[model samples]
Target: MANMYDHAYDLEKAIRESEEFKGLKAAYDTVMNDPSSKEMFENFRNIQLELQQKQMQGQEISEEEVQKAQSVVQVVQQDEQIAKLMEQEQRLNIAINDISRIITKPLEELYGQPEE
Candidate 1:
């Protein structure tokens, strides 16, 4: 029987070659290639990371911080290249989530699904 790790590697390779990955990569490249878009995208990503880190640390997110994050989201949403990149990213994330559910089916079957 083939090793599970080998199958996992194959899945990784397949994902890299998938259309969703290709679309996301292209969108990312377009955003990064332009100076203004690159800066805006990087700044937006930094803010998101900061908020996520704060939440992971169990710190309360201040109202000012929430407003700032919302403001940044509005700005990024208005940016055409960044908007496209975000849409592509969402598509890729959905595809990944679907794959994750499929891969975890065996464990779910063994343990049974949790009550909703």
Candidate 2:
């Protein structure tokens, strides 16, 4: 089995290679570091990244990949004291997984559910 960090790294690579996430990150960083909007930047970037992850999941990427990429987001946004981002990330992780499972309901029933 892969360690979580290794899994996370792979996910990071996946996200870094994704054009959509990259564009969002560039916009997010701009929104964050701009002196004029520093206060709102963290909140907005967090939400945007959260939405990006959801978008990735809905596009048929692995749920685990989006979630792992999100944890890495914490390290990226730390200077903003936006530790709340970590909590939000975790919650979104759950939401994305739930959504993925919901989308696969037919397959799950056909193949039988895997052990949680």
Indicate which candidate wins on lDDT: 1
TM-score of 2: 0.32
RMSD of each: 2.3, 14.9
Q: Per-residue lDDT for 4 in model 2?
A: 59
Q: After superposition, how far is residue 45 of candidate 1 from its true place, in Å?
A: 0.5
Alpha-carbon lDDT of model 1: 0.97
Candidate 1 lDDT over residue span 7-49, tens digit each: 9999999999999999999999999999999999999999999
Number of colliding residue pairs in each model: 0, 0
Q: Which candidate comes out best when scored by TM-score? A: 1
Residue 51 lDDT in candidate 1: 98
lDDT of 2 by residue, 1-116 (tens): 99958976886677566654555555556545666445644545666677677787886556676676666555546744344433444555665577568767988798896767
